[model samples]
Target: MMKLSLGPILWFWDKCTVFDFYARAAEWPIDTVYLGETVCSRRRELKPDDWFALARDLKSCGKKVVLSSLTLIESEADLRGLRRICEQDDFLVEVNDQSALQLVTAREIPFVTGPAMNTYNAATLKVLAGKGLQGWCLPVELSRHTLARLIQELEAEGLDLPAEVFSWGFLPLAWSSRCFTARHYNLPKDNCEFRCLQHPDGLSLRSRESQELFRLNGTSTLSGSRYDLLRQLPAMADMGVSTVRLSPELQGMEAVVQRFDTARRGKVPAFDPLALTEAPPCNGYWYGEPGMDRVARTNAD
Candidate 1:
């Protein structure tokens, strides 16, 4: 059966809200839950100890927990945090950057590569697998054709690491040193007053004509439309996708998980794309088309 895992919360939420969200998640149908801050290091509503405690609690509830490292390591403090995450023996670590990968490999720890790590070709996957890569999240921009070829290449090389796909949620595009959210508020990145908390979902950046183009989440820029692959579950299964990840959102996450859970069970649940998200759905990247195009799923695709 294909597993469903919840990605780490990308947007900043209050400490209580984060706790409550995970507390509810413990009872959901999700088989795995990723914990910790994967974006900006300054969004510290929950400290290291707090995240560890949460991970422990989730594990006790029978959900596999993985601690994710920061994507952009700019300072010594960020490297220190990455080291601490890699040092954990109780949970798997999701390496989001090369620095984190080095730290984990130095310790000879098996780690999963996050989507931001850019495992585009089989060669890269083989190299990481040689470094104790247990699994890898496919980069968001790669198409189904590319993934199929990579899978074939991996099989030919006798490599058998599980492939996890970011099947849902806003696609995180890029990260920067300058916080677009802070700039929107006319504040410096150093003391931005945690303004991201105000918009549970990152502030949306729309075109002058009012078309949603992108989302500004701290230092990360995300696709404006939520990437929906609910209809492609069967295709994913046939492609040997071991797990499908659903990025956390501020609202209706339980329903989203339930819908995916149903689809994974070989049942095609009714899914209205627009109702599930603030913006329309997009699966063009899966079909090797424009990232924003909505392509219907078919066996041919």
Candidate 2:
């Protein structure tokens, strides 16, 4: 069975809400829980100590916890933070950028490559593996055909590092120095007053025609249509993907995890993805098509 891994929470939320969210997640059937802030460093609802505490709790629940580094590390402060996460040595660390990879490589510690890292080919995978990469996350834009080819090649070479795919949630497209959330509120990025928490799951971008377009996260822009792959569980399993990552949402996360869990276990009669989220679900990337296209529409109104 393909294991379920809860990706780190990318959106900002109140401290109490964040804690309560994970408190409920601890009871889910997920095998892995990624902790820490993967977006803006300014979002400090959970500090390093807080992440460690949460990770410990999740680990106690028999879930493997991974500390995720920021995708865009721009400052000495960010470097220091990455170094601290690398030094912890208590849990797995997911490096999202080259700087974090450099630190992990230098320390000779095994780490997982986060989806933000542009790992496109087998050569890149080999180089990272040589640097002690224990797992690899396929970039969101890469199709399942590409992933299957890479996995097949790796298997032929007998390099069987665990593979994880971004199975659900909004597709994170880009990260910038400016926070779109603050910009939308007519505020500066540095002194924006942590405004991203106001819009859980980030703010939705709409076309002038009132059509859903993209999501403006703090510094990251995501696909307007959430990238859902619940209907493609069998394909992911056939591709030898060891884990399916479900990114956190603003609400209804526990039920989402439960549904995927049941589907993966064959307990459900037919996987009803309509019960997942409010956004339109998509899995076109898996079939080598546009990511926002739906392979299986479940009438999720």
Structural similarity to truth (TM-score) of each candidate:
0.97, 0.95
In candidate 2 the C-alpha lDDT for residue 42 amounts to: 91
**Residue pairs clashing, model 1:** none
Query: Where does candidate 1 stray beyond 4 Å?
Result: 270-277
The model with the greatest lDDT is: 1
lDDT of 1 by residue, 204-267 (tens): 8899998888989999999998899988888888988899999999789998999999899999
The alpha-carbon deviation from the true structure for residue 53 of candidate 2, after best TM-score superposition, in angstroms, is 0.9
lDDT of 2 at 287: 73
Which residue segments of model 2 deviate by more than 4 Å? 267-277, 297-301
As for model 1, its CA RMSD to the true structure in angstroms is 1.1
Model 2, 1-301: lDDT tens digits are 9899999888898889988988999888999999988889998777889999999998998999999999999899988888889999899899998888989899999999999999999888988888898998999999877998999988887887889999889999899998899999999998898888878887888889976778888898999898877777777777799999999996788878888897687564355645544567777877778877887543321
Compared with the true structure, model 1 gives a TM-score of: 0.97
